[model samples]
Target: MKANPGSAAGSPTPVVEAKPCGNTGETVTERALRLRVRQQEILAELGVRALRGTPYPELLEYAVQCTAEGLEAEFCKVMEYVPAENRLLLRAGVGWEPHLVGTASVGADLASPAGFALRTGKPVISNHLENEERFRTPELLVEHGIRRAMNVILQGEGRPYGVLEVDSRSPGEFGEQDIAFLQGVANLLGMAIERQRIERDLRAMVEEREVLLREVNHRVKNSLQLVASMLSLQANATDKPDVRHELREAATRINAIGRAHQRLYRSNDVRVIDLAAYLVDLCADLNAAWPEGEVVARTPDEPVPIATDRAIPLALVVNELVTNATKYAYPGRQDGLVEVCLDQAPEESRVVLAVRDAGVGLPPGFAPHASTGLGMRIVTAFAQQLKAELRIRPLDVGTEFSLVISLQAPDRAG
Candidate 1:
């Protein structure tokens, strides 16, 4: 606790005068002992009240009033340290003029009682402000007729937060007990102030972390898009049909993943993706890339939120299947129709994704497990990663590929 510059020995302005025991005829010494005990009891109760979760300002105000009432001082105040301003700001007070509670500030120099206590980490006591020589008398105290004062530093974690002080219009000496009681009140007040500071810091950290995460996702999306652009440029420049086809295909795959990252960056929650929006955007990109086929996606009215780890693989599976249908499903037509459907099972924990084409079905004697084609292999691998079953059915005039993903899997499909 901080020190007070003034001594505690002097006459007191009678804020509250000690009265004789009624009809008991008790000795002066006994009466003084009883009064001291009662004072301790009041301080103890106020200490408990201070520990409650009341607003800091209200509680601090109550604490100062309690100090004044308990010690029979006419005035009391709590001041908070502002290091940047190098001043002690009055946070709460009792018996001060109304304008002074929020407006008063004192220099945090050796001349001020609050500053003296903060510097020395000890209690300061003054019996007569008029005769005090340890520190210059503050004008506010003199204006209010304060003659006696005691102050203690409000310290937390061994660092001073501010000061708690009680003053009187009368002059009198303050005993060691008075100083000790004020110190106790300061200790309790310090704890509350510390708790608020820590909470504010934690909230700031959480907000900062969210901002950083979004920035990382945004940068990643931009970088991936750059790579996709490079692949497109390379594909357009190549003269070999097969090499150009491979590069375009690579670019589409990179662009598909980039779409997912971009969506997450724009979303409020980074941990989950709205799969419906994701599929629509993916299909739109595919239609533009492969204008020979018209790609369309259908989804439910409510949002379909998928975990981050699962959304990427799910999007890729759809991309590969739809691209294959556009390439091989329609042989003679310039514009084939490919439909992608996403639905949640009505009675089971599963998602069913179906991609269908309105053109000639798969070639005769085709087998999914034995197919050496890259598209077929990729579809099968993604199906296994999602812990879903893959099925291909030949339509009367086209082909359909379906995957039923298990939502309860221990780990998300690849």
Candidate 2:
């Protein structure tokens, strides 16, 4: 083998001579064809691993090993370009000392073979590194007595990732065919690196958005609670019984919305609410708000997920029904029982929410649609938004307001 003295830098200058067939019956053409097929198979294997999302470090090591095996070379390495240090770190390699694999560094200037390939986005093959004048042999290669080396730039999105280099200790020449194999490995590695970077960035973005949403929910809860407190103060200062009752009712509705935001701020997932837990908490708050009447809630043991948009409206509907019952259910007596039940309906993808009170039943011939009460109108509008079926059934001694809400498919993006 002879060196090409006039070959330009960062070029795949072939200096290989065809070896004799020896005792085997195979011709030189047949051997070349077989080697080429084997190289293609190696690339296919690497491609499959890359697509499977192999771990970054494991993928790098595998790529270098396969590259060395494909070209039948003694050494191969993946160098990661460190822009700050202006050097290339030996990130992964085979046929190198364990201490040197992650610790060794090489010059990343045009004077070095690997650096020339990375800077020019070209392939470099130094069949005679010691006598090569276009680029200097790196000290690590000189220590290993590497006579021939091939370098290819690892192409990435918008920037070059690094360099892939294969070296040999034996007195053999690296040709154009070897450059093709090395470059193929480098391309696959670069693509995998880019994909990993994109996935990591997406995860970080999602985390940042969730943090901001939680902060917004917390602020909204605080503001709603402040308004409720102000309403309570105004009710206490009022002399008219009717005005006081109206202000207190308004405060209760505002409190219900505030509590929903409180739950969202505390939850890991801000997009959905746990209906069972929310109902129980809401009933507890209602009991505290109305000391004369006891509010009880029965819900499924497991969580029922409802989107935030539907949850707030459904919560308001419950608050209105409970408030109406507490005010009108018991006329003379102060002690009364109100029950709120929430569970999955027997029908598929449906939920049942029923608020009932053991008190004087609804007025005779009363029509919910014809009623001109503000609370009833509010309930009707929100029920329409929920697309729920609202049924009012008068029991022997109480009234039951039943709402059957159909659950939609959960949003996967959330």
Candidate 3:
């Protein structure tokens, strides 16, 4: 090995030998075979890591380091092509200044090894930088005493991403086998980059969809509130008590739906909601609807998440039960307590909702489905919509209504 004057003191400089091409010598062929075996082993390990969900940055950094070690080269780098800027930005490298790894830039011209590989979509090699005439030598390369370089283009999802290059201070360090190994490494890196980009795009799309859903929920809440306001105005203008009562009840039901949508908007997840939290807010609204009753909610520590599709009917059912408790459960009275309970029976794959009022018990021999009241009828219809079994019985001091519905578990990512 000949020592370079520019090398640091006491550091061994690599010898510049004649360039090896084709299958000219047994020495080159044997070395290529050994390198190919090592390359295959490294590629297999990297492929496994990718499948196991290893971080992309860590995998990419390992790839460059693996390439440098496998080919016995002093420097290896992965550059990302920026066509918009007409440049190649260094993304990862081995044996270069630390700041150069992520911040370095080089021109994307025929004169640069990275650019030449990208432009031609093929491999390029310069075994003798001092006397090479095909392209102008980069200043950084000369400064680092680089005597040889080999570059291969990295193709991402059938499009060009950038180039992978290996540099050595020793001339003739790269041969046909080294180029082949770097090609394989570049192909592996391309696949990893493509996967990372796809994952990022999917995340962005989901975020965008969530934002749109929240906006839609806000609009729906406003529209429902507007309808409720119109119904209130009509109720105020009515002369008949029955007509006014019916109009007000209709407005309350609409408002219930609006409140449900509001909860969905605030939760930021349109697909499902924490049933316990939703009921707490809902009962507060119901309690404030009247002047003589208070509604309290009871739930487990763990959240019971129900999908929006099923939640609407469930919300309506609770509304009717609570409304009935406040109105008739304490006939001619000025004070009462209504308790709403939500519990999940995991063993039975069911969710149970019960509304109990500490007021007058059900009238002797009274039937729920046979009731003539609009609220009771609405409750029955909603229970059927939920595919739930409705159960009604008299408590020791009041009436208790229960619904047992099938539970659908949340979906998980694979």
Candidate 4:
């Protein structure tokens, strides 16, 4: 039986008995063992919640409530050290007035019990707060008529965060065994708080990098556009037909690259491109370039994500194939149809891009590898760079250029 601290002066201190586990009459040793087991169970539960990454505010609240219940104490709290003010803020707690929490402060100097624990990196227990001679009792405790208290330092990798303290108003002694349980709870809370800090820092770094990358893409696209415009002006100034034709072709290719960068600048993910959408946009540009002829794009409705590095080369290749068909496919006509198709190969890990025209066929027995034309040479170089297969089929009245590219895993941002 234990004496009630709230009993009046002239009346008998009412006795409270510890309940037995069963009707068999459990011994004192058995009761102590049961209490220890229950404490261990509570610690295990807190550990699991910490590992699962529970938010720090919720985790701290749970820790204090469970610690108080495990010790059968009346009050528990987690204090955050405010180095600037040299005090501890009541960050989370139970058994305190709602208004006091998050607004109350306690001394963090060696003269106070909690302060001594934080400074020495050791736990403090004062079973008799009224007659304690080593440290002065805090006014907050005195106001609540606390008879005993325990303090444990909460620390992580570097400096100490603060302290975890439990107080009791009832008449009881806080033993050495109680310190171990309280310290365990403080350790888990410290580690969890550190993890949250690291995660927040990493997320901020990633966001900053993404913003910088998007800015770089935007600048590159503008620079390429400027260069292409300069080339177009030079092509118009030249009097020689051959020089004019070559300069215009060079400008067209530069514009294609600029368009790819523009897409990256506008996209949410800078590492990859949507092949279907890129093809549709490219076809629109080609139609505007060759208003006399029509260029049609046929692609799957679903998005096909491709790495940014490969997307530029694929766009350039498509541009070259379509250009060739529009120039030489029809001998003397102004109106012709060129089709560009993108699809996945059936039952195979490959994608096929084909450009076909129905105006005229390739010269008899012509070989792409043996061709000396600058366009064919450019196509062959880019195809080798991509490690893709290039196939040309001669139709009855025109030609079809097909590029078979092996699909690769999507690239992830580091």
**Which one wins on lDDT?**
2
- lDDT of each residue in 1-414, candidate 2, tens digit only: 344553435444544447676899889778778878999999999999999999999999999888998887999999999999889999999999989988998988999888988898878888788788888789999999899898899988978889999999977677777787888899899999999889889989998988889999999999999999999999999999999999999998998999899999898899999988889988998898899779999999999988888888999999999998998899888879999999789997789999999999899898777879988888999988888999999898899999999766444585
Worst 10 residues of 2 by lDDT: 1-10
Q: Where is model 3 more than 4 Å wrong at Cα?
A: 1-32, 346-349, 409-414
User: Which is the better candidate, 3 or 4, if ranked by TM-score?
Assistant: 3
Q: Give lDDT for model 3.
A: 0.81
Q: What are the per-residue Cα lDDT tens digits for candidate 3 across 16-132?
A: 323354475557546556667888898888788777767877987898889998877899888899999988888889989999988887777877767888888868777677887
The regions of model 1 sitting more than 4 angstroms off are 1-76, 93-102, 126-133, 145-149, 166-185, 300-303, 345-353, 359-370, 386-414
Clashes of each: 26, 0, 0, 0
lDDT accuracy of residue 37 in candidate 1 = 79
Q: Kindly report which residue stretches of model 4 are placed more than 4 angstroms away from their true locations once superposed.
A: 1-25, 96-101, 131-145, 347-350, 394-397, 409-414
Stronger candidate by lDDT (1 vs 3)? 1
**TM-score winner:** 2
Q: Deviation in angstroms for 171 in model 2? A: 3.0
Compared with the true structure, model 1 gives a TM-score of: 0.73
Q: Report lDDT per candidate.
A: 0.81, 0.88, 0.81, 0.85
Cα lDDT of model 1 by residue, 1-414, tens digit = 133343332223232234445688887568667767767887777667656666777888788888887787889999888999888888899998778877898888878887888887867877677888778788778888888788889987657898999999864556566777788788878887787677778979877877787888899999999999999999999999999989998888998999999998888788888888899999999998988668999987778888887889888889899888888888776788999999887647678889999888887898887899897888888888877789888888788899887644445364
